[model samples]
Target: MAPVISSLNPNHGPPTGGTAVTINGSGFTGVTSVKFGIVAVASFTLVSDSQITTTAPAGTGSVALTVTSPLGTSNGVTYTYSVGPVITGLSPASGSTSGGNTVTISGSGFTGASSVHFGTASASFTVVSDTQITATAPGGTGSVPVTVTTSVATSSNVTYTYVNSTAPVITGLNPNQGPTSGGNTVTISGTGLSGTSSVLFGSHSATITAITSTQITVTAPGGAAQPVSVTVTTSAGTSNALPYFYITAPTIAGLIPTTGPGGGGNAVTIFGSSLALTSAVHFGSAAATNITVNSDSQITATAPPNVGTVLVTATTPGGTSTVGLGDAYYIYVAAPVINSLIPATGSVSGGDDVLISGSNFTYIDAVFFGTAPASFAAVSDTQVVATSPAGAVGPVIVTVHSSGGTSNGATFQYQL
Candidate 1:
């Protein structure tokens, strides 16, 4: 009985055909030949009595495909060969020369596409469907014809354009210098800042906060002391580097005799590094009266009138010193006064506990009995208990000395 052919897998192929076709039919073993039209297939495999696989030779148009075994020739099945692929359109026909742009191609006969080209450059491509292909363009310049080549033929129906890349330009930076710890926002102005991929300070990368064609805002990254290059990168290219300075914030290591009167007229010497460019000195919220940048390590500033303990800060172009780090402090006190004295008279033997009453005596450093130093204990903010020293039989004045200033003398009589 003659073999009966039912179907052929992939009934169509390119005209320059090398397509593998699977024949499904009722066929016995010992298949002698498989033919497409009058041409014979050079390579074929008989998997079973009901299936045969064969390679189609180069041909064009539709033709009768048949299998002939020792028993009888199989009934003919039809197979058609396709023409070349045709590209109709290209999405994003223009891109930067730096390349890495995805272009979508819409066309017909795109199935089994072998190669895609942009001018003389070969592009990596993927066939999405019979009518679509997505390609990643290679680096190129100027306009180029894009083509898709199949086994049968190649089609050139679209043009891809390569535009000259524009490098980013930096015009200026706001608050150029910052603390080494770095979390300050810096506004960078320039051209071609749009689509920025990276913002780098020195070798560190900054976090981008906002971006525009002419401006970009980014948070600075921590860096060492010195100047570093700041640059922006986009798809086009890297921009010219701008200088960014990483400065250590001014520090106040010591304040000479860190206490003063509430009237605030004392010149306090500030000792620290990074003080050369001192712009402002602050005592709490009050600005200093006179600020002198004595050197990079020292500053002389007049303490502003303030009360209690206040933080002192030195400011420069880099940044201001942080408050409450110790060392940088000034305690403002009300000047001590001589209100009265208990036991105003004492024996010349110099053994007497005199209770001195006054305001602003909390920090008393010394007590004097008629120009002689005496032992004293600060009883409170307004009182000091002092031992009167030996003196000649006469009227002696007792006084207290504190950071607030020396108190007025109170008359004390000493008996000979």
Candidate 2:
């Protein structure tokens, strides 16, 4: 099938030729030749299957332009040779009173434009081609007639209105802190952000995901672990900047009382840096509750009911703490219990080693011999060795304590 020529960018240029033009259409791949009215284009470059670029060849009056490919020859479009600069239209015919916004003036015969004037004031301008010139509106007030000047002739006048417009104002940024490795979405709340041209974090540009008159969402770029200025730019000007922080990922140096009961509800202190914004703490797949951040290096959260061993991690806006960086492992065990006491009796003067057998005694914290406390050693999950403390010659109730809870009471006798 033959390629198609939709339209030409300039349609017109100097009779002497050498005007840059972009051919827009479809099926442009493998284009073999191009011609400006049978004169044959000097050279042409195929940009894509839908576009082509080439210099307009020297021609007189109106001529047909076409592209040829191995499939077939394309239809021709009329291309004209310009005699002088002409102004057909202006984009954003209005700008701020203080000026400095780029305005595009579009028309044919723009080749060799020497200057652009807003009323009597000369404005800086760049000729993009025979059809477009971009001018930075000079400071002015009220409406002014803008015209383009070339050696051959001055283009027709077009009205450019000047009025004061407020620069954007930023009120806040949600989740303003994120991992230094970046790739986090941050929402910006502000005013006058319509038609925003760019959003910058510090000096780096962020990819805008969405935008509106009062809010914008952007994918943050990678940055250092420090504070940076976040700002937005639009036609009016750059907005007021808000502070953003780039934080490194949180770490877990250690988890105090690394083991607890499967029933849960125990305070566990997490120690590490970059934890000031900790939002969640997890033990295995279960989330902890009542999390309180003590500082940048510490947080306390009630362990949730979970069984077996699991990696404990703290998550913040900065990032989640990874395992292998610290003591991030936790185990859940059953409560220690005292099934029976050996000899069950000890001297009132206080030193007697007793054998305490029970279920779940692996993490015994302490043992009670009646009203007095006793020193104890856990030999296994179900046994403990304890020395009775001095007391009056009488019987006392004995118990065991562990991460689970206090165990059922067992009888222990004291004698004279």
Report the number of the highest-TM-score candidate: 2
Could you give candidate 1's per-residue lDDT for residues 219-293 as a string of tens digits? 999999899999998767788988988888888888997899888888999898889878899999999977888
Prediction-by-prediction clash tally: 0, 0
Q: For candidate 2, lDDT tens digit of each residue in 1-416?
A: 89999999878776878888899999999899999998888788888999999998887899999999999999999898767777989888887888899999999878778889999999999999889999999999999999998754577799999877889999999987888888999999989887787899999999999999999999999999899999998868899889999988888889899998889998999898888888899998899999999999999999999888899988887788887666789999887767888979888887899989989887778888766789988888878989999988778999998887889998888899
User: Following a full C-alpha superposition, what root-mean-square deviation does model 2 have from the true structure?
Assistant: 12.9
Candidate 1 Cα errors over 4 Å, as ranges: 1-95, 98-120, 123-137, 140-165, 277-289, 315-326, 343-355, 365-381, 384-401, 405-416
User: After aligning candidate 2 to the native by TM-score, how far in Å is the CA of 280 from where it should be?
Assistant: 4.2
> Against the correct fold, how does model 1 do in TM-score?
0.59
